[model samples]
Target chain A: MNWHEAPDMRNWILLLLLLLEIATFTFLSGVRFDSAGDFTAYFQSYLGDLITQSTPTLLLAFGMTLVLITAGIDLSVGSMVALVGCIMASFPGNTEFWWTAVPLGLLTGLTLGFLNGALVAWLDVPPIITTLGTMIFYRGLCFVVMGDLEKAPFITVPGYEWLGIFSGVIVMLGLLYLIGGPYVYHSRWLRELFMMGGNRIAARYAGIPVQRRTLQVYTLIGFLGFLAALSFTARNSSISAGSLQGFELQVIVAVVLGGTRVQGGSGTLLGAFLGVMLIAVLEEGLRGASIWGDTYLPFEISHLEYIFLGALLLIGVWVSNIAHQRSRA
Target chain B: MIHGRLDYRHRRRIYFLLAGNLLLLGLIRVLLKEGSSFAEVLRRAGPDVAPVILAGLAMTSVIFVGAIDLSVASIIAVAGSAFGVLVHHDQPPWICYFACLAAAWVLSMWNGYLIRTLKIPAIIVTLAGLPFYRGLALIVADLGIPDFGGNISVYDAAYHQPGKFYAGWILLATIIAALIWEAFGRTPRQWLARGNSEEACRLLGMKPERILQSAFCAAGIFLGFAALIAVTRLQAIEPGRMLVGFELHIVGAVVLGGTNIFGGEGSFGGTILGAFFLYFISQALTYAGASAYFQEAITGAVILAVIGLDCAIHRRQKQLDELA
Candidate 1:
């Protein structure tokens, strides 16, 4: 669980892959730079926008890393965020959002997370099954709350737009990943999570509070879900029952790509960060190069994203496994 | 039933599902309008339940060998895309059906191959395949059709025969075949053995990997029929959007039917009943005049409640075994 435990080989490889993607897509997108400064400016603004747009995913990836470390997954995350956003949207876009809607949304997320934890930890329902069930149930609740309505009241909320901006998000990520991440990385708390994930029964028999740890990890994800919902709603300035569909998989993929084992017992927040960026870059690159794809490819360029993302996940996991085996040898 | 192969839990699940189905039917009958016959319920049951039951059966076989496929819905989309492309080309209906079946079979076999070759878990392989196959479907449709939009429309009645007309017959035949296979086949027993313990299976001279692969092959065949039925029933083949959330429903049905999620024990009869029970639960919601939005919530709650209760009931036994 050391920050330097896995070394930096995978990160360097991912960084190179990200650079290659940007280079290819930039050429494909026909970005014409008048000067060196112009190119730098263009890239700066592009990166800024990409980070701003993908803040929710990045935040969730932090939480997902911890969950994976515990050998549990919260597939209900997307639905949880959507439901929270929908709940927030039900209120007016005034200062009341601060005192009423936002806190309520956070509580809803905590309650939902606690319920998921109870099912998995207390009732002994498998994490996957519990989350799958909750994924549907939470989504169903979203539909009931919003009922085919798309709410956009966040635009009127004072200072809410800050959450969507580069500077604001940078501060948040700096705190979460830099300050909070390192704290958790070095803590006995996280080591205990690793222990539980590596072997739950062994940890339990050793007097680790297994049930409490499971509950805490899930509840922490819930708090992260609240932050994610805030970031998502502020940026999109809208809410709907179906918003953020397929988002859980995106977060899971990014974390997994970061070399987080699905079997758990180990993960790094830094890896999750890099994984999120790699995917965010690909997403933006595909969008920018859509015209190129239209000309050179038979399918819609958007469809290629799915293909690339899927291929990237498989390749990432396969290569990681190979590296893992080689290191073992 | 079916000799001693069917266990106590399997029988209990079958009974539970059957009772639920009948209870829903009775409620619907009692609440029916004067003119509407219970016959309407029977008539609509086959096509409605066919795909889910088939998918459940497919999943049951895989889960029997301690693996799962989260890629079934995506695979269905691929099969549907193939069917749509063939129909667009004015291929014979039978040819289109055969091609659809082949697409499912090949992809499922490919799933087996990937899991075997990579030594990665089936869940991870299929999780990747989920989006990969959907993208493959979209790419296939985009490449095959001229002036392709988001969806390919197939309005020909001839092409809809399997999904619309013959779904019942197909369901009956497949159910019968699967039940018989579960009862007496060496393959099913082998799957159970592998699921129960891979090392023990190897010690007994059986190859666990090969047995697992054969289960996938059997699942592929069942999924082929499921895909055929699912695709033909749709008037428009929207590969990207078609059959979204189908894998969950199939998983739900299989688990409800008393199949262990961790594998090693189950019954095809239970799966058939599980699918019917789910279908009837939703149908009852419609009849009870519940809001459409509430239906999904109710379905999710029902699934959670059923599974949660079952797990809760067995918690003490599991704890005791751990202590032992």
Candidate 2:
């Protein structure tokens, strides 16, 4: 394969970008370490905080990879997260809240995902239109449920904050990416998803249960949304109807930036991990470099994150697409 | 596919939307206060509803060519920001409006150009544009105006002409022209042909990519008017928050109008009816004394129910065709 054609080459480039981002940000932010012990502790705390804070986005990105791999997109994941959190937070902050609200949130998430699946699989509505409708519908429901109130019942719930820390990030992401990812990467089920994405008719003709698999994939995302809600609420400790208005874009950008074919049929979980870290670092770096920006630039440095993100997405997808075509030739 | 017959369901959908609009109008009539004039309500509906209608028309043209522009709200925001910046610079009103129109047209064409050259799907391109353009708007505002606040207030009456005084005329003229062009012009037929199957269009000796680009070009004209009306109607243009979630509403209305979401099988006439139907639904609810908070949820439900049922009704035919 040509250097540009190899998937390994693509990932290496992403790794390069990540390192470049970190080094530049560190320099611009002008932080210095005086001692090895101090450096180690700072590293530990910063990594922990970064991973924990972005847990909601990371969890959503995992499901998004599966969805995109199957040639479907979910515009409603952001709304789904908010709706789940809103529903769960409406309950009184007591031990009973966990038992009642948690179950309800799970049920709601699964049901919402099922709705999207049914629309796509059964009614034959295109996934974009179906989810676009449901996105608005779900966001509307969030408002109806919580009105203007920002509820934080999770803050008062005992032991819930555990999910917001490094330990929680380890368990949740490990289960999805570390364990389940490899399993799916090698499974016949994964092959089926790729087949469906490549061409739906051929997959159906090959005796794949198209509707069932579609439903399962979508509902699985819903369950992931439930987990995301848990992580987000634990960290942020409050929820509103519009809490994550543009969140689906972030997750989609990360997954797409990972070199997942938007046209479907090919992706790797490892690539997705790199994609997430790259974006997360850029975001954090831009934020941290505000002191540098205050004097040098007119606009806020943090605002530049949007421009970088858009540029990154366009460039990332364009390169990955070229790679995909070149490798085939 | 280039010569595929129009779907009966799409034809029926137009009638359904028409009926829905009439029925909602009746409800609004019945619920109106004793002293209020139904004539006034009818007259005011045009300017109030033109933004969505115009935007839906733009979306319809794009979807007709198997593409979607999710960056519409962002495009409008950028246009609005351009208008605001120009206004703040004390440019004439016509110049400001023209700048707004031109900015929208250029960005829309840029979306077309990128999709064509890069061979990326329209959805992905515009999805990126959604944020990129909004940020561009804010940055433009921040740099262009001194001591820029979040929003720029347009206090001049002349600045509001397109959205306030001439919106109805602009909408009517555009719709009439669009419907006529769609019915009689070769370009629109080419768009439908390209939408049906780009490969087929190519084999037929038509430039499918050019056809697609032309569709976007045409959509830019309609979108220019949409941005003009949407921007000029507002007393203040806030680049960050303006038209937030407006793209979804336009998409919903377009889809609801019986246009196929994937493109190649819908009418501009149906889109007009769909937009009116949605507007009247909200009007009826307001007149019926429903809470404002419930209105958005109800609009969403209506979109889901209408589109879901329509898709379901068409499923049998789709399955037969696929299995064959």
Candidate 3:
């Protein structure tokens, strides 16, 4: 029950879930090969598609895991993505110009994130209500800025396609794993996030500077949202107010499925990374099977993905609860 | 010094609540003067505002227990969609209505069970239920039930009467509920207990879980009835759009009516006034030639402003309490 005690059972469950996900993907993909000629092609393309679609979610969930570990939720991430994507797409395409556009978009996102942080940290607003208000406000701004128009040309820029495609996802995941993993595991300032989430008043009394840390956490989430926006825009080659609709929910779902407690205190970014992959694989695999598919249902699978995700989240929570109960007992 | 301080504190609290109500009434008057016929306006506003008032009432109950129901809108959607499908299948209207209500009640009970027994946070439980209910609604919609006719007006005698007179009925019900609650609903005692500390409530042998469960169940029933009124009035259900963001509106109303979002202190009367204030503003904006988009922005602003005001009042009260 102590903070440093490893949640062995939850970790094992996470591994099992990941394995089950891979198996499901394999089975759903039909595992076809005609004399091995098409085997690598089908396999690579399927894996590539899964990685590509999941990149943004993975990045968002990565940051979300940390935020949730601090016992705070960011409902504004999706709106931040839309706002940042719109800003990036509004710029005329030129590889040389992306340096400016991307940074500017990130700054805008960071500023919005800081606003969220300030509200919660300084103004004493609850995270849920503060983020809820910002969610509406930011999305409204997006609509106002974009005029509700869906811009397609910016996404199709030369060299930009890689951002939405598999290569970009892999690169982003790699960089995060390199940077975020160590910062979380090794640093004192960073580790306090879990302690703060575990018990804010105690952490505050312990000189953990709860308010400042909370602000930093939300601001970082906003920055990650900017990165996700870049990836998403590059992939779809389109930007609209509706671009990342319902995305925040997906990120939260992924985080929870990864076994992060909503009440905060403990979680691993690695679990979130794997969680995104699991969801992506499930969707892609279900699609490849063509059992029942529709435009709304990943275009290649049935609407069952939603139900499946919900069930997974519930089961994950239940299992963790049981583990916690038993550990306490 | 103590006597004077107590007198000042009591007067200040009364003044604050009165000022909030007066500001809302002023907004209503401004809305009433805008374009529509006075009589037609009342008729239209009645049905349109009824669900919000009812839902706000329901939300108030949950807020009293310091919990929120994000899934209420989805419940409305599911119930509306289910009713649409059943009625389409030539099922008796009464049967279809009851079934929808029953389903919503059961789902809410499930939420209560999860929060109480499983000890899940109310926000997380309701957040999950929000999507689950939406998915259920969508699935039911896609099951090949015929769409309710566009602009189909329900003229069923029984349904028409409720739609026509429900506003007054809601008002009466709200007054009765508030009186009953104030007199015997354990408000003063629970507030005293929760305000002291949750630990103190347990030490005093209060069954917090039972209280919360009952509150959620009651909210579920209220929401079901609100959904029924909305669908019956439309005479055709569009689950896709029926109560989208309706929960936010209810929350806004509750908060504006002076209910503490953090819980324990609120009034049903204030909530009724809050609902009327919102309905009036929307009606006014339309009459003033504002677009629906502007109306939404205004509503959002109103919600923020009300919450902001509540925060100020709460801070002042805390200061006074400390001073005492």
DockQ-based CAPRI category assigned to the predicted complex of candidate 2: medium
What tens-digit string does per-residue lDDT give for candidate 3 at A127-192? 766776677667766765677588876644667777777777788877887776776678896679
Q: List TM-score (chain A only) for every prediction.
A: 0.96, 0.97, 0.90
iRMSD per prediction, in order:
1.2, 1.2, 3.7
DockQ of each: 0.72, 0.66, 0.25
By lDDT, the candidates rank as 1, 2, 3
Give the number of the best model, judged by lDDT. Answer: 1
lDDT (tens digit, per residue) of candidate 1 on A170-253 = 988888988999899899999999999899899999899999999998988888888889988988999999998888889999
Question: Model 2: runs farther than 4 Å from truth?
Answer: A3-5, B1-5
Better of 1 and 3 by TM-score: 1
Q: Which ten residues in a row are the worst by lDDT in model 3 chain B?
A: B1-10
lDDT by residue for model 2 (B19-66), tens:
888898888999999999999999899999999998899899999999
**Models ranked on TM-score:** 1, 2, 3
Best candidate (score: DockQ)? 1
Clashing pairs in 2: none
lDDT of 1 at B47: 84
Q: Considering summed lDDT, which 10 consecutive residues are worst modelled in model 2 chain A?
A: A1-10
Error of 2 at A149 (Å): 1.7
Task: Enumerate residue pairs that collide in model 3.
Answer: A155-A237, A287-A300
Question: lDDT tens digits, residues B1-324, model 3?
Answer: 212322343334335546655664455556665473566766666567777887787788778777778788888878777776666666777887787778678778888888888676676677677667776776676663533332223445554344455755754675576547655666534642453366767788887777777777877877777777766666656655567556766777777676666676666666777777767766666766665555554665666555555455566565466557
